[model samples]
Target: MARDYAARCPVYPVRNAWLVAVAVLLAAQEIGAPKVQVAEELEAYPTESVELSCQFNDGGGLTKLTQVSWIWEPSDGHRDNIAVYHPVYGQSFPNVAFKDRVVFLHNSLENPSIRISNLRMSDAGRYTCEYATYPTGNEQGTTTLIMLSKPKNSANGVTVQAGTKSVVVARCEAADAKPAATIEWLAPVGGNHSTSTTSGPDGTVTVRSEYRLVPTPADNGREVICRVNQKTQKQPWVYPIKLSVEYLPSVSIEGYDHNWYVGRSDATLVCLANANPEPTTITWTAASGPLPETVVVEGNKLTVRKVDDAVNTTFICEVKNRLGSSRHQITTVVIEALEDPSSAGVVAGAVIGSLLALLLVVALIAVLLTRSRRQQRRGYPSSGDSIATGSGGSNGGDYGNKARLLFSNSGNNSSKNGTGTNNNGPIYTYREGCDATGTLTEKANDYHHHHLHHASTGNAPTAHDILLSSEMDEAERRKFDLDDSMEEEEERYDRFGGVAGGGNILPPAYHVHRGHAGEEMDVYLDDDMESQRDGSVISRTAIYV
Candidate 1:
């Protein structure tokens, strides 16, 4: 009977307070009035269940409940029946699907509550509950139900390239919510970014944020986050966007500014650069001069085998990547010729000094050679003038005054050579010079090997040698100027013939040859005295008688 009344009875929505008061008055019926109430509002998320209850006089004595009816009135539609309930004849549902999920919490006749399961966005509206009493007529109340839903896969990662005049846009959505969500975008580098939001018919909001980034090397790996905040969610949904940037190479030459000499050393130039997706190739070129003979290029390194042509050249090292190319220059100079005045002065001075030293050495060698030849001809020792005195001839080492030598018998010319005693004496010949220099050693060497008897037994042979008497002016007794080439010749007169005239000052003797008996000429000792070998210092004095 209750199921039939619910299926045939007409129900009106409790739209306003006036309709609610009328239903309360009808249910009272002059008996003790019962309080009829339902939940003021219902809040639920998507895919959840909700219960609408109406408790009339819960003390259980004022009114007895017969059946319960439910109503749903959309804002744009008319009132409609949801279901009805009875206690004794078993409950019935308008739709068979509602019967399995709807359970009543009817502990007493005053409480008749119905539960709705698997609610959707379309179920979000005001619901009305009407309770019929036994002694009273009927009472009705209302409840507002709201369902919250969010879009799936709404927070997706976005890839964006960061560049000048470049923009990256991403959208984040939160759907089927009671109220629209607040939208915001947070960038990694900059502060807050601007965002745009749109609402759907179901009160959901989508936030789309556009970021215009002026990228430098500093902003390569940054992230831009897009966020949407809803009242139902614990935390805001955040979508991060990737920022990729491509840039040109910043290049520099590894080896720079060098000074080198020609044909001395080689130079190597390397290109150093920093770029994304490391550089592919690096080439080296020169402003002037041909390429080196042996040129080897290895990645960033370029080696020039010989720097023979590197005369004030600017070598450019170019580095290339996918983005762009950049180059750096290294200036070099090879000194083919130097015209520095100070440096040239120093070199010239060194060369001149060397030449002077060489000339001095050659002059010394010539002097040495001439001295050597003179020594060989005169038989001299190098250290000044020296003498060996003892045995002469083959026994030159003996240091003595006189020693006899075994010469040929033909050397005996006693009549022409010596004084009255010892007619046969060792003969000697020596040449002497007056020079004070070391060449005077020739005179000393002449006396070394010759065996000459000294005049120790009697007065020595009186001899006088006048040098260059013709160059002296006899009238004025002054020396006449003579040329440097003119050498003084010695005029020696000796009175020591082999005649047996034993007088201190013998008269100048003359020997009359058999063919020229009438024309007689003076005769002297056969040879002049050699250099004294007895280490004696000889002194001469002239006495004019």
Candidate 2:
């Protein structure tokens, strides 16, 4: 059956050779072999010393121990003798490759283990402990020495790839590790992945991991990390992959479709988009208003050129690229007017300034008015009303403390006389505070006693007394004029007996006369013969003129 299969299957020859070699080694080690076991297998570094342990387990029957030998077999070549130990001849290393570098652990009884110094990469291979006895023949056990190597990374980390929804290409490799290196994807994204391993002639390994992903916009610019783990290294080796995905534009507006006042200086809108191959053209179009005559559509900025009552309209901004195009729309509100911010400040400042000035003026006027009132109140008693008595005699002294004065019609200042003298004026109305006329007034009851005394004596009048009355107030002067008018109607003065008119003459006495209408007229007795008398005619007896 084997011969028939070898003829049919061309790969059978190669597989049979590998099987035969392994079978022969197994057969040799099983039959008549001493119980020899290698306890430890160790790693080696150049210029370092290491010991490979071989222990005798259930030692097979042997009358005399012959020899113990250590053999070195490289991974790519045949076996070699590292050293041999004998009870009498001692230990000796015959292999030129491990000449001075190897020694037996025991001196007598043929040591089964050997120590090696100044280890080199060439010394990395299988090591065997061989026992030689008279009857048991040769028996051996083996251990392998592994050479250590640091891992290396491959593939560019910044390679950009255009990926689709179904399949995205990403690759990472870790090379030059002793055994096969374990490769894994740290961040497993999108979909599944596959891996492969290859080996070098020196037992160095390379592991390559490939990823097939279904990428989306969210995955654009993502980093895919590949990690390689090896037994010789303390930590896993890692590499990053930057992925870029190409897709349609994702569109938005930054500043668009907002209310803009009519008087605003600038009204602006913005359009934003993320796309592959970038955007080549940017444009703005108006729906209801006049579009800008010449607008440079270079960027995402959209300037609403004509913002007025006429521009209450909608606007559209378009961003275009090689892959696709995107558009955004915005509407404007037609506000009739907007307050100028700068001008508002100015108007407010002016209003405040004007109000301050008005308040200052009002305050100053109030201050001046208050001062005038105080001065008027201070000057009231002495200057507003005054009294001067020309007569310094009993009449003046009597009138000094009087509250009220009433002059009778029969007195020298009475209405019996047509010409009233001494400025005994009419009564005047009194008002509070000072008047604009600046008139002066005084009570005249102080002169009543003197007047009575003078009348009893029948004194006509003194020039000094009449002169003293001349210095009267406005109220006195007005009263005198009123009395004089009434007296003129009631009395006619006789030039023969009454006081004289003109030249400031004083009144002598009071007299009454009858007129044509049978009215009595008060007349002054003429002292200078200045009055017309009835004796010119024959009095009332004569009657006719």
Candidate 3:
């Protein structure tokens, strides 16, 4: 009975224990394991290195032993086993490229972390970290490494002179690059140019650019720049330098006046010039002809003394510097001479003489005209003279002849009386010549026959002849003298004599004459000869007292 009980209990009880173990294994598969997430990635320069690290959760297991492994996968899908560690296998690396350059700092069974050095372009790839455990199954962490290229080395230098023509050369170089950089000159590009490129000792390429041009005055204060270009950049870099240069001088001249007159005492002019270096020589020369003896030049001043009338005289001022020489010219002219006072005086005298001659001719013409008018008013021929006479008789015949004689000689004494006259009495003797004495006598008988016919019948003898004889006295002759009178009396008689005298009878009588030797005879009479005249005979003489 005991043997039969042990066989039955053994198969049945052991089968039940195997079924419980399978159930526990199935529960462990349902819970998920903790994992490390790689949220960011990095890349580094060619000369630098990178490290990747991660943290994990053990899922409450008492045993700390676990498996960790590192693997690398290239972009071409090739996998490389890098590092691994377990409690039994210890730390191990599979590839030679990761021998010393790759390192794991933490124990892979407890933690998963890594470091890498001496990175190269070939080491660029994606990496993975995996963990193995009993309770919490498999987990993974990922990392990516990328290599970066370095910038190329390019530089240049330049030099220039101020204010002159110049050339500038810029050289640029770069080494060990997949693609080379381009070189350029950043200044104005239109002038002359030359370029050369040569390889350096280190297998790097170097380029040189040269530019040549004539500089201006504005270039003195300006700058020249060089620029370099690379493929990775949008803008180029610049380097700058200043320029300087040297040159020649300029000249100008100014004078006191435009034209210098002849016989001027002095003439002067001034000159000026500009140059970097002062001029060594300054000279003044006559441009047209030889200079006068009085011409003088002192420094920049030109002077001419005692200038003469020599057409146009030209002068030049020349200035010489180290670089070059320059000159300026001036011209002068002279005037004619003036006249003297003697010539002016002669002209004035001629004019005055002509005016005086004209005045004299006009006055002579006026005098001739006045004399012609006077002749016309007097009823006389302008070119000749004439005389008229009348006769007087007794019965108006001899009496008319006597009156005519009286009128003709009114201005003279001859016709008034020639001898003594009687008035109805015996004849009287009239003295013919009383030359020795101033007395005259008259006889009665000489006059009786001349007057007897008119004496009777109450008719007396006319006393006209007696009164005319009385006018022959010395006192009346003295009163008639007109030579001593002013010229105004003579002019009145000559101009108006006919108009002043009317026709009238004058008295007539006898007269006695006397004379001195070598002298003209004179006439005289006594008043007693007219006393016996009768009243019937009329006396026609009108006496002016």
Candidate 4:
């Protein structure tokens, strides 16, 4: 059956040979032959050592160990001896390709494992461990060796000017890996990517990837990352690169505050430019006329020594780079003055004056309030007919204290009638002794003697003496009151003209009574003065103590 299948399919000749060898090995095992044990697969890196293990299992006592040998079978169907072990001659490497690089760990045929040093990519293939038994037959096992290599990674970005078309922005490569490496790109921009693979003569693979995007000025300096992954690396390798996009110079002017006025100094304007290559030339010019003589020109800056009307015009700033040139303009206005220096002072002075006026008003109000309180305490009625009452002595005799009453009318009709029943206007009242609460008291009798002396001289009390009595002594007060009363009485008498004016008038009513004390008399009087329409009058009445 094997021969028939081999004849039908000529492409499977190597498979037929493997099947025949397997059948022979199985037949030998059934007849109690030795079994050879070897690993099915192995892996190694360049410049490292590798071990190929082979062990003989003599399960059947009928077989005796003779020799053990290791062989290399490449993918091209060529076979060669790697190392051999014999009980009589020890170990020996017969293949010139593995001469000094291969050695057996044991000289005995029971266990023969060979160690190969300084491994190369070409050494990766199938290794066969064969055992020669004395009585049964030869048995063998094969192990496949695989070689791995770490790849070299690199990445770079291409410098480009802004454009509308999509183009390559960055490239990443992983070169010379045992197995082909996979590459991916990471970027902040939206774009597309492509990957390609290449193979070298030494069985190493290389992978490359490219990122493409529409170039723009805003995309410049953006980071693009390349990630490479391979079998030999524990983790993926990363490389970051920045994209470079060039463009023309963009120009702008700054530092104009509109407050540029006459006599202003240190006013300046700066020209700012953005470009890939640095700007080489910066210029300042006047758009309407020649620059003012007070203007100072520096690189990218224009300073005014002193602002004037001549500086009120359009100014232009031109910037130039390798790409092109750009210009920006600014219009300036020169005013006669920035602000009035005294205006702040005027406002502050007004505020201070208002505050002072407020304080003065408060002080005046306080003074008026104090005067009103004093008047109230002195028993001066705020509104009523002017009324004066005398006090009696301690022993019910004459108190000997007197008061003078005066009335003045400025209009034809007095504000109040003599009966004290009219309410047309305010009136006045006075009492000799009063308490702090505005209640009249009888304490005036105690000082009646002091007052009587001034009254005996035919003097009358004045409004000033009554109002300011707290500030004067009793005698001083009496003297002022008496002098003021006599003058006022004379003025009133002349103004009234009671009999000289030829008008019928009634005499004042008087009542006199004897006192309990020796030669003491108590007297009471009521006086009234009235005039016709369109007349003015003044009246005074004196009371002796």
lDDT of candidates 1 onward, in order? 0.52, 0.56, 0.51, 0.68
Q: Candidate 2: where is the Cα deviation over 4 Å?
A: 1-40, 44-126, 129-136, 139-141, 147-219, 222-227, 240-243, 255-267, 288-290, 294-296, 304-312, 333-349, 369-545
List the candidate 4 regions with Cα displacement exceeding 4 Å. 1-34, 61-68, 85-96, 132-137, 338-545
Per-residue alpha-carbon lDDT of model 1 for 1-545, expressed as tens digits? Answer: 99899889756565676788988897676345436778889888756888788876645466677877777866566677677777776555665535566677664445668888887666777888888776758878889887777644254433443356545434455544456666666776663345566766654555554565556666666676767777777777777866665667789887644655555445677788877646888887777765555557777787766556544577788878887788888777776635554487899999999999999999999998987655433322233333221111221221222111111112333222223233322222221112211110121112222323332452222211111223212431212223322112110111111212322222232232222133433333222222323222211111111
- lDDT for 506 (candidate 3): 23
Candidate 3 per-residue C-alpha lDDT over 279-382 given as tens digits, one digit per residue, 9 for 90 to 100: 87888878666766777778998777766754257777788877678887767666543544357788889999999999999999999888776645433222
Candidates ranked, most accurate by TM-score first: 4, 1, 2, 3
TM-score of each model, in listed order: 0.47, 0.45, 0.29, 0.61
**Deviation (Å) of 55 in candidate 2:** 14
Number of clashes found in candidate 4: 0
Q: Residue 292 CA error for candidate 1 (Å)?
A: 3.0
Predicted candidate 3, C-alpha RMSD: 27.7
In candidate 3, position 244 carries an lDDT of 42
What global local distance difference test value does model 3 have? Answer: 0.51
Query: Which pairs in model 4 have colliding backbones?
Result: none
Off-target runs (Cα >4 Å) in candidate 3 are: 1-34, 58-66, 75-77, 133-138, 157-545
Summarize candidate 4's per-residue lDDT along 17-136 as a digit string, tens digits.
Answer: 999999999887766643788899999988899999888776656778788889898767799988888889888888998989998887778789989999987888899999888776
